[model samples]
Target: MGAATFNRRSFLKGALMAGAGVASGAMLSGCAPQSASDAAGSGSDGAAPMTADAYEKLTWSFEVPPEPVDESQITQTIADDFIVIGSGVSGLVAAASILGHGGSCTLFSAGTKAVSRGGSNHAVGTKTQKRLGLDYTPDTVAAHFNNEIARQGYRMDSRKWWKWINQSGEAMDWITDIMDKAGYTTTLELPFKDPNGTFSIPGGAHNFYGPEIQNSANDGEPLLTATLEQYILDNGGSITYNTKAEYLIRENDNTGRVSAVVATNADGDYVKYEGAKGIIMATGDFSGNPDMMAKYCSAFADYVADGAGDYDAEFQFGGLMPGDGQKMGLWVGAAWQNTTPSAPMIGWYGFPAPCSDQNHPGILLNVEGERFINEDTSSVYAGYAVSGQTEKKVFAVWDSDFAYRFDTWEALGNNMDNLGITPVTADEKAAEFEAGVEEKTYVKGETIDEVLQALAEQGGIDVEAAKATIIRYNDDVAAGNDTQYHKCKEYLIPIEKGPFYGQYNQLGPAQFLCVLGGLRTSPDCEVLDEANKPIEGLYNVGSMMGDTFGTFYNFRVPGQNLGMTCITFPYVLGKQLTGN
Candidate 1:
């Protein structure tokens, strides 16, 4: 009675009834429902009372339904040598590699085409590790990963980390080869200067090539996924888009391996595709799964709302990551790894426009109009800028000089124009400044005092306290050292410039792609269960595997994420699968 442990007899009673496929109505009618307080009292007092009706309900039996197979009507579909689930970058690469090596495969996913256009791919800059001419050996890559893991306090599985590192280099080479063979040219070179002054391998790295170059021109995820899809078809692999893997069917005893995948298409008709050899899970992370995100990756809890869809006229949040693999794996006694270190989301550091430019230079400030972290540290710094602020909102305070620098920055020219941000001279920006102006969408404030007042009026901060905070910042800048905030020397420029600008960088929930952390797999890409045992016939590639980013989201090395996908895991998994 202590923990209400279910003995074999009790478990079997319920299991046998459930297995018989009893109707819910019949089962409910036979049971006596108790009040919530009564149930709680039973548990607290260490006694579970089963009424006569409840016992009878537990003893009821129902006939099992027949399998939905009609010999005459059912078409016999031959099993493939391998079946890959989730046709994202990793799935496509695995499928293509398998087919290229004389193995046949069928790729399945929920979306019509893989939604590679998600966060990482959409905003990725075009850069390649090889072009940077950095001295990045495979060992250095491994060390970087080790350092990352150590930094994260070993919260992730070290074994999986080693596996990914061991195979990353070859994976990069293989992806590059595939792109080249497909007529895409690998041309982009690494752009940023490594603050560490040492070359680090790019993440999810790739260079575009040929006729598909323009469409797949940028370092976008969609283009990369599309290219990989084309390669699969070109190499004799079959792809079934708009298909979802509902569950995995194991052997009769659930011991041998994954035998077949039960999938449904757009019409909801189910098909059991047997995989005689292997099954690979390449679905992206569980950021879309609100429960999973909340449980495993809580740092981005505020962003979960953005990931949810409008359900029944109410807004919900969480990863739409069906978590097909996670659910199926659990049912089959498989283990999951890297439940921590979720893929980091990029934070935007800009404020409302005409005072802000999403694509270029902008300054970030906390709710009290204080700059917390280095704004230029990483592309994700914007998202991290407002993290843990008291008011949960930040301010992007900039003037004409900031706007001019943003417009003139070469890397931002194309992006700014695309976003309809025309170049504005310093004088033009100053002339446009408004004092304590609160429009529906944009909040503009001229003087530091006016800005704080507007922010207070708008419910973003306390007006009096915010003014005092700003005055202190101005004093620090005047003294040539930001003793209070420790801001960069360059940014210490006093906000004394007339037409001083400020806008609310709302810290409300928002969704962006980039949820890290997932199933743990070995160097050969074999996914292991929660017990650290291999899930036979199951492998993982892409974001599904963890430890790609060791510790913090280190922007010191660009393209490491893409490099891992485009260059590392695909080939590693391929070699292990094909024994090449």
Candidate 2:
């Protein structure tokens, strides 16, 4: 399973959890001593400090095992050309690439099998994009990246950002070639339209369309992981299941090289695997660890705690990625990234659009029925805007005429695939609206007054205030200019039409697919020490590798996060390590 699979499925269920629960660490034996309290400012009682500022300075230090595993108690030891921790896309891709080049590899996974996988890859200019005639260019994307860093107030390694995007096309081609041979075909996912046009460079967000991996007798379907896993094994590599990489065994000399990894096997026995070349850490983010989240991701963590929404709902169903790789790296003196806490990449979660704009044109309103932002904005801004609202709740109000006004298939039909929502065809939208009339997921009224009355009674909106808002909006539409928000005139479909509708839309504590910000790494995915030198024979990939993003994930480019972490960087690191 890739990272996106679990999130998509859980989001559909609409299970909402209230304020944050006790942040529990993963229970493991033979890894390290279990502390009554984690190091993220928790006391012996396992409770975080009450105040926010105290939580900010908390040390997120890892507790090393008190003593090394006794030689007599050691289980079977394995030797490999390269050791890869974490069987997620990063590790699997690296292992497969290494083995493909005649290098022996061993992949260790914390869970019983691969789980929590995603499907999309963001590429620059590829054969697919060329054929699709998408106008996204490297220069444009570079500019977008530059602007994003400035806007978010986060810094990225410019060299790394340029290097990754420069090679992204080749990386996509390489991975898709392997996937094609393995009976998997890459399909272009839906792209988001900006106010000008499609935000994606023609054929962005490529998803692997293939057979789902078989269900494990234990838990977690291989899904996207199955193909890469099989490729590695077919090439004479091995995957160790139910094994947790407890620590990186660095060389005793002053070279700062991590020579091997020590892991806890399924039998609760310690095992060591020595890597002749290097070790790649692909373990995902630290969202599962409450202490780490509070210490670093405290802003959003506390936001969710104060009834924003369950930010952890996205990870509730999958492997609790407890920042094991991050902890292991930090224990070896790797520098934590000096960036904003890992920001979540959120989707619309079926948030309706209020207006019609080329890119993300929707009529967004606060709970009080007042438009808060220009509806034609990116999902990142939309998510941020809603989160800042008093209630963190919004509504995407439209009318029945919206079906006839826009390309139903393009607008609402592919909405979910474009981000997150049920795929709605024109007929489905009409049908669902009728059903929502009965179910009240949608409020329907024959007249404008009727709709306002329904909205006032059911939606907690003030009838008089709501009427005044709509009247003003309609007046602006008639004047051919939006005075308040300055939304493009084309999207200002007045609410004057009959049969209005609206749905409850929440932006924040909207579950994120994964959090960015982890161990700082170079362009080639080498983990850098505190002195800013590459730690020899050590690399990191996947979400664990950081320094390419800032405060927020770049939602502007769909799949870029997975592209850089899971595909591009792993491939680059693999070739570098293998001397290919």
* TM-scores for all predictions: 0.73, 0.80
Judged by lDDT against the true structure, how good is candidate 2?
A: 0.63
Q: After superposition, how far is residue 224 of candidate 2 from its true place, in Å?
A: 4.0
Which lDDT values do the candidates have, in the order given? 0.53, 0.63
Runs in model 2 with CA error above 4 Å?
1-57, 60-67, 134-154, 190-193, 196-202, 210-223, 253-255, 302-320, 353-360, 411-425, 437-440, 447-459, 508-510
Error of 2 at 275 (Å): 1.4
Clashes per candidate (backbone, < 3 Å): 40, 19
Candidate 2 per-residue lDDT, tens place, 362-425, comes to: 4666767787887666655677777787567766567776765555544321321232333346
Residue 525 miss distance in model 1 (angstroms): 2.0
